[model samples]
Target chain A: MDVAIKEFILAMVVLDAGKVQGGGCPVFHAENSQEQQKTSLYLARILDGVVHDLENGVLLICRH
Target chain B: MEKYLIAVIAGTVSGFVDRWLMLRSDYRYYPTYPHAYLTHLALGFIAAGLGAVAIPALAKPDYVAVTFLVLAAQQFRDIRNMERETLSNLEKTKLIPRGTDYIEGIARVFEARNYLVILTALLNSAVVYSLGWQYVFLSAPLCFLLSLRLMAGSHIGDIAKIEAGQLHFDGSILKVNDVVIKNVGLPAEREKILREGMGVIIKPIDDNARLTLDAPGQRMAIIHDAVSILGSKVDVGEPHFAPLARKQIDQGYLALFMLANEPDLEYLMEIIKRVPVLESTRGTTLSSLYGRKAAD
Candidate 1:
């Protein structure tokens, strides 16, 4: 799916095993580009992190 | 006269046999035509000629001739550098580039094979010079066979168990065997992976095997070689659909997921079986020896 660049990743939350562990790796957190959400999603997948949309601007990644 | 004559013939034959075994294009159809084949063969002949004279020269009172072998080593180093540069340049033009580690491995193999030719020829010459023509006739074949054996390195099959695995979605999670590959939220992507993906589980036989498979570069080599042989169904742009190896870190097992052009499980497995175990990635529990008593 094609995600527009305008939205940008608002923030990333790391889940250790399933629990929210606060702000995740900054490398995956896009400061002002929604285009980075796609990248964050891909990196999360590589790490085998369970990703979820916690809210409108935040992404949650659960690493097992 | 017969001794030196036997050295020339047997040494040349031994070098040719070594080159014949090594100058292969099985992994990557490199050096594809008459030009490349002619070049390697000519170089092989030269290497043989150099080695054929070793015994005759060394046996003479002047030992200065041995210095040429040392010089030959410097030339082989250049050969390796050339191979590495050529492959690196060629890699940029390809869609799925062979990573630097694999490129380095191939370059090293080419350099070492030349030395193997030298060793085979020199040994054959020595045997003929010491014994006689009859001994070299037998010894040459024996030496050729030894070179063949030495040249054959270990493959993934030698150290790991590779088996076909099933891909299934647990809720929104995509998994191969028991390993969680990713969390697929899109049903379309899930369907695409399930319908097209070939899943394989590689179980390392020991701690050493686990460590070898653990490296990202080693896994990339496996994926590149397998996809190159089978033809990748996806392209460089499709990062989401690209072949990937996900490690089950707790147990140190690796699961490979790929959607290749062929999608033939048997073909994929056969190619994976033959992937050379990367020597640079080899690791063992004994590297640290923290758990063992010193005396043992």
Candidate 2:
């Protein structure tokens, strides 16, 4: 990941963490826009990978 | 002979009234079993036969009175049993999953309530038979009216359940138990995300049906977790957020990464919307153009 993307991802991590700590609720409605729908699909796909990697200890996050 | 005719008239009239009340009432489900409806008619005929057989056999009206009183007591007990069954059903349905099963519960309750109404009619028949013909005629209509009131109360309870999102249409189909459910997600935590990943889970409030979407990569893993959260036999599928286009693959990856961090459905939707347009024109053209247009 690029420095910028990593930083952006890091910001999101912090934001999500705040929500969890604050007892924030999850969203349920379907996406309205095509772009958003695509991004959502992509994000779902990636997390899908991370979950797999974490399962097998293949994640490169520590090395990175 | 005349007394028997009177008893039969009273019982038959009350039975008809009870049936009409149940059919016309707005109770979501009938509490009475269909067999109870048949029982009402049978009771009417039997009451008439008993009146004929017993009234002449005993010269004193007091003996006939005792007979009616005993019958009324028996019928009342049956009514109570019916009411207990209805309440039990309500309790059982409260535990039933809201959705399709909920509707089924409503139907079951409705049937039970209708049965109670029939029991009331039977009691009224006994009371009317005990009274002489003139009084029997009067009692029958009054019993029917009371049955209506009982139904009205049950309907009110039904409406309350419908309003609490505890009841609604399952789809295009309008059904009693089909309830609209909103599943709110808890924002992900850092450690939790590391363990569970970013994803949204949808679960039916009452049943073992659930859908979990982990942010893109190993979505299957999230599905596995959902299998346990929702239990067995739930059909799991992926969330169709976007198309797998070739050009925006990197943007897709970025969106997936962001989703892993946030995993909030609304936020994910907003970010995902920006992905394609952001990817287009080197990720800045449309917003810049709009910004310039606003400035100009």
Judged by DockQ, which candidate is best? 1
| Candidate 1 segments whose C-alpha is farther than 4 A from its true place | A1-64, B1-5, B183-185, B291-296
The DockQ scores of all candidates, in the order shown, are 0.08, 0.04
RMSD to the hidden true structure, all candidates: 7.4, 21.3
lDDT of 1 at B286: 49
lDDT of 2 by residue, A26-47 (tens): 2222223333233333444454
The TM-score between candidate 1 and the true structure equals 0.78
lDDT of 1: 0.74
Model 2, runs deviating above 4 Å: A1-36, A39-64, B24-119, B154-296
| B1-296: candidate 1 lDDT, tens digit per residue | 66677777888887887787778866667766677777777777778777877887788634777787667656767777878898888987776677888888878887787888888888888887887767877877777788778778899988899999999988767789998876554445678889988999999987778888998878888998988788875544334566778999799899998888888998888888898887677666546676234313
C-alpha positional error of residue B296 in candidate 1 after TM-score superposition, expressed in Å: 16
